[model samples]
Target: MTQLTVFGTLTTLSPFHMAHAGVSAEIDQNGRVRKLGTGTAKLPCTPTYKVPFPLSGDLAVGFDGTVRAIAEVPCLPGTSIRGKLRRVIAKRIKRHFIATGQLLSREAYHCIQCGAFSGDGIKANLTTSAEVIAADQQLFTGIFGGGPRLFRSNLRTHDSYLYCAETEATDVLPVIPETTALIRAYQATFAHPFIRRDDLLDFLDPIAPDVIENYAEAFESWQNTVLVTQERKALDRNAALEARAAKKRGEVVEKPEASAPTEKQKKVMLKGQSALEAVMPGVNFGFRIDIRGDDAQCGLVLAGIVDMIKEENFGGKCASGYGRMAAHLRVMNERQEEFPFLDYDGRKLLVGNQIKSYDDALESGLSQLTSASFEAIYNPKTEPSPRKGKKTDDHDDDEG
Candidate 1:
């Protein structure tokens, strides 16, 4: 069980949002949906973390005469956290080469780190003549997995739940009554609702005069057809009702022919308004990461985590001032002995037990990462030529 575990609390410095691709609807007494709201992935995935409802069966009603249930709790999913870390690491590596003026070929770069962090597909037409390329491939695959040889990742991440005083520190989120109580308490606070405005139509300064005129004409056409469209809809509804009545009376009913949609119906208008849900600031999520590698491997993962933390953004909607979190990480051995991995005092990244400065640690980490093999593969003086061969017509070359 020789593993290095990094455990910490990530406090939200700004509103955090992780989109869950589903809708939550407000139910009425008759079980009919009154309204629908897009949900965020902040909800807990397991029943162990779900809030307990009282036996009284009393429920809260909304202003629109709809009943809403607050049975689930919110949490920061580890998959999203892992995805964000991987992206930052890949970006950091790319920026490092660009800053050093290496200017490696796109194919060569892809060959070096294909299927490492993001996907599990081998890039086509890569010629591995040099051992340096293979070594670099191993380095990346060993850390993140799924390179040419498909090495398993040495690091594992666990789902993170809201930090509660009663919960103990563990790699996997504990399934206990206290955890349920924590979920219950967190459900009480819930997510804050905010209206995201569509300002694209409001600002037209950059639009060309001709383009604006075209838009005006289109809008005018839509306006003129509005009354006609309403009348058509009403007529269609009446026809449908008559057809239903005729069927009920045992009379044969001929279905109407399908008509093509008109241009007015296809015209883009103002986007629909949606109330977005987001986790508020000042809430802390407990997270844990286990590394089954030596100091070098651990250091590399820590470097990426530190780089991502420096950006101070996670999950989604970061550009709109959401998902900013401040991390407080500490590394410990399997025996529970503290191992000085890295430290971030909200500004600088200090590494090792001695806590070296950010620059020094970065230099050391980069040196270990870029050894003789790496230099041989990415010689700055020699520009890598693009792979020569017939390009495949496969459009499935997505770098997932």
Candidate 2:
């Protein structure tokens, strides 16, 4: 007889032994130890004899292995390590592009109608769509070789698909509105490296004055959001600590005993649990925003979308519960927008509010406004995208 334990995400324990080699072992829903195997071979009493189990799934016995009694294996911690690694990788890739001055290119800004931006002072918007596609192609080929070629091809195809889908029957000559155009331009401009010089003034000269100011503003806004999230997490931790202290001191903390949870409470808890699981899959969630154009438009667009989703009941039901959900949104242009959303079953949820032209979104702040509109569009729906295929090498990693 052999005794072995299986550990995985499911809360059920399946025991296997030599006698039940072909049959499946029954496990309870709560994952508790239930029954032992029946196969037994009595031997002369020896002081050190113990049963050994092989780590491999194969049940066949071989002559060279020693027998030892099986013991419980410790459970592995889920996803925290993977999350850290993902953040590191995203940062590294961002830095590499910035250093190489390959984030933006002159060829990215050809005029759609006449290709007039070929000369100086003609005004141009960063071609974010093209730049991101190029950068991702470079990264995929550089790191993973031919494996990511299909992914790169898919992304290019998707971009073209989006372009056609979003722009069909629309004219291309209209000037994009100032606000939206600026956002796109900013994304393209900032992606470029700041040229180094002997003097501080010379170093600063390479960077556009407006670019520096805009980055500072965006950075400040990001900092404020991060601070608030940290403060909320701190408050939750403090409350938990206080509760533990009160229980230790024998203080009468008024609370309900373990009566049956109400239907609403049960639903909220279930949603919270699901959100937590969605945000942190078996691996850590990661995002990379590659701005091939002048500004981090896509990244900013995504951040704005995440903020709206967090506020409007996407992360379970309440703010406290939302904190427990632990979503990490990374912006990477080469791939489609990939992030875990409970509403989307942790799959890519494309909210296509395709405008006739970039000018339409620019004039109306389309990305920002439509982000909210799309939330309304998607909030009630639970269906996954049929377009979402199996996890390929090019698919962005998700945690949940």
Candidate 3:
């Protein structure tokens, strides 16, 4: 069985900053430390974080502190990829599952990217941990695994994409005794990590046992009501319109006059050099997308993803031109056949017998879909909590 495989490279055009760095101390007119900014105080440091996945032992004993070796494990979290892809999917299929129509989950403070339950691909309930272990058996749970749309399995971010991190040659060598050099002038930076199906399952293990306990309950109690974001609810235009109409009807309304809108400012915290670490440009990461079958829905999804890369920049700093990268897409069959989707500007998808790409569909536009669309999908209110299985408490150790 030939699945749809998409393999490509992501060439970073600029420095990628997944974090927000406040301007630290700056250089004054003279060669003295201004002492105002929150520059790190680690005494000329490099980032020391294992922010990526597929956790390794490379940083075992004295590697990072001694060698200051630049690691090549800046893996783009699978969740992040799912997020970006879903946004693209939402834009194309007119499905807003990625952004809108969210309900505060039963779990305290648990939020989301709006997800679909893959249901372990059984369309039935799983009663035991053994079943979960068994079900996961023929599954492809990698970053590009097409399982989400194929097996109907529920997945919350678990895949880790790949990236490369390099160390400067000068940093690798020491001044005197390689192991005795107490003096150094530089540090190395690394990327994220690459995770597999097993690696991502770490997030689900907590909910493993009773995941499908209330399967029917979830599907049954699901609601289709659309709720705007907390922010939107405050600025509802319909309420304002209603207030104006009520006043025109000779009814005294208590609506206040509109005031100038003030933009909310983010508070910046000052941190010393201990807080700086990021991915530099000129780094490339390769990706592979494999789908179970070659279907139009898949084709539309691919097109939507391409459009996202074309319209928006990658990573976090688009406004500052930080995460700009190129995505090349193509479709292939088991017979080693390849369809260069990128070469076409969605024209090929448009001329098909049916609507192949959502670029033209009214329902496919993301802006058109909102909390209302989720009404037709699954309800977050009904989603089973990530916490499952036997409970543990202080009383467990007490005698009856």
Candidate 4:
């Protein structure tokens, strides 16, 4: 049987940051050494966290005790890609089950058989682990395999390295050492510095009360409901503890003081600054995924990949518009002569051996996954309730 492979180039639509904890110390303009990392440290203004991009290796310290920059090669590990795809696929599967309702109890059994859905698919629990294992043998689980037995996944995702202009070949992903050689000086990643200001409302306080009445009310509500409630609770607990300690010391304690917002709290709420080392928008990376499965499994996996590209953001700081990527993908069988597939840009997919629009392709895959024939392989009717067996953990290694 020919194996299916999905190969692609993923290009960043926005700046992306994946922080590595390795710290580097360098002398600032003030001639004092400052450490850079995704950790707490004192900055010129205030103590804050600094986030740095994943480096090829930690910065080296010279014999003179000065820290120097090492070659930096930004990369996206396969684990991140695989983990996210599994989650998206699982979510889609659950939604499909929900959409079908009671129209197909047999199809619902397939989900129940696989323990991945957290019992949403279970109508009645099977008596034995062996029975559960037999019932769980569905196409999705068979391909992405994770359960008590720790079955190996049929899918293998390769680490994607940063793609430079010289490495335009997306057919095969290059290794880190090779990628480092291809890196251009101008293509080195840089951090985007930003200051977060929570004091915008403070400036508005000076405006006439009538004009700012709505804003004031909204701010007051948030401050009272969230910040004040939490802070007061903490303060009250501390005060009570102090009173208890004084009583133990045989000293008279005056009435405990009401909690007041501290100076540190004011500083934290007013202003903050940090920087994230990030790859610039439009940077590309080469990725590959190989799976030992039939067309049904291939189509399902393809649908999940498309969903991740179109709807989800990768890496860190997605809330700040980082990690958005567009995929330029191609799908094919290993023995090209046996099962031919066409190259695909971001907007299309292979459905029934023909290139189809994204929506149609997605629908086609989901249909097959939700079909009766697909689920019949693990039909609950075929299995009888066996002797009760020991419970087993469903956790499986992501790397597998």
Strongest candidate by lDDT: 4
Clashes of 4: 0
Candidate 1 per-residue lDDT, tens place, 74-113, comes to 4677776777777777776667666765565553455344
- Residue-wise lDDT of candidate 2 within 1-400, one digit each (tens)? 1111111111101110111122211122332221212112111011111112223222122222533233211111122222222333334334444564434222321211112233432122222455435433332221111111121211110100001111212222112222221111001110111112322222344564456567656556755664465445334433544554567788866641323334543333322221111111122111222223212322222333343333323222133332122233323223444333222223333332321232242323322222222121112123433456577555768845
lDDT of each: 0.52, 0.26, 0.38, 0.54
Cand. 4 Cα-lDDT: 0.54
How many clashes would you count in candidate 1?
0
Q: What is the lDDT for 196 in model 3?
A: 21
Residues 255-349 of candidate 3: C-alpha lDDT, one tens digit per residue: 74433222320011111112234456655444555555223334444554566556546656467666676544455556777655553231232
Worst 10-residue lDDT window for candidate 1 reads 40-49
Clashes of each: 0, 19, 22, 0
* Predicted model with the maximum TM-score: 1
Candidate numbers, best lDDT first, in rank order:
4, 1, 3, 2
Assess candidate 2 and give its TM-score to the true structure.
Answer: 0.17
TM-score of each: 0.57, 0.17, 0.40, 0.54
* Angstrom error at residue 60, model 2: 17
Error of 1 at 116 (Å): 6.0
